[model samples]
Target: MEEEECLSHSSPSTDNSLELRLQRVTAENIKTVRILVSSIFPVSYSDKFYQECMNNELTGVVIRNGEAIAIVAVKPENFETGRVLYIRSFGVHPRHREAGLGSFLMDFVDEKGKLLKLPHAMLHVQTSNKTAIEFYKNRGFNVDCLVPQYYQRCSPPDAFIMRKPFH
Candidate 1:
């Protein structure tokens, strides 16, 4: 993916009042990213996980009115002539929901993965989060399987392994 061109778009919202800019971020943009994403997640991650995401190279931050309102972090790999793009975490600020920020990030992920020649993008979402499940399903992601106790720390413990084939 072209780092400089990664700002997918910055069009105005439905009413053309606010502009949402999707910018690709590196390890240096960690502070705001961590704060924005942390506020959206229902559960808190360990410092190590946050640190990894902060230090992760493949991450995007959505900015609105000069503040970050959404983020999507990823870990990508190429193996055996096939490429895989994994979504580490995706979250949009509660106040920013329904503004299509999440959709933008999801679409960005798909586009980025395909551009990177990754045939598939994968992720695990908590089973109890029906909203997230529906959001992903509407975007062509299918539940590959159920991971029992996938989140050892979360109360629900179960997760849905979702995948979207881009090739």
Candidate 2:
């Protein structure tokens, strides 16, 4: 089935409010995703990044009261270790932080990873982003290694490759 069709059939596990729903990214809502990303993260993404989000089944947004409040976009990639789910971008809007949206979106990713049998989930977190690092660690992820200058335009470009093995 098409990813968008799959999304239309499935329902959010916890959210029963009609005003709050999860939807897959599409050409129509891609703009909203970009705007939300810009507001939450300091980095700018490439055109290819946004394109992947619209085409991939693992990319999605949390809509609350007609606005995207969180996003989790991922892709499956072949690593030296094997197939892994790479989180390309993930963030909850600043206004929605500390309201459990981050954890909720993460749980959504974990479910997607398992459904795809990806075996592991990986993402990069800026070394200076202590909150994100702690959040990943709390979700059973470990700092796999430091990648110096991973980010080109961000301050303290260094990043840590965090991974969670959950086969």
lDDT of 2 by residue, 62-152 (tens): 8665567888888888887778999988998988887677887787778888888888999999999999999889999999999999999
lDDT of 2 at 62: 80
Q: Score residue 66 of candidate 2 by CA lDDT.
A: 50
TM-score of 1: 0.80
User: What's the CA RMSD for each of the models?
Assistant: 4.3, 3.5
lDDT of 1: 0.75
Q: How many residue pairs clash in each candidate?
A: 0, 0
User: In model 1, which range of ten residues has the least summed lDDT?
Assistant: 1-10
After superposition, which runs of candidate 2 have C-alpha atoms over 4 Å from their true positions? Answer: 1-20
Tens digits of per-residue lDDT for model 1, 1-167: 22322465455565476666667554545566667867877667677766665433466777655467888877786544356898887988888888788887887687778777778888889999999999999998999899898886787989998888986
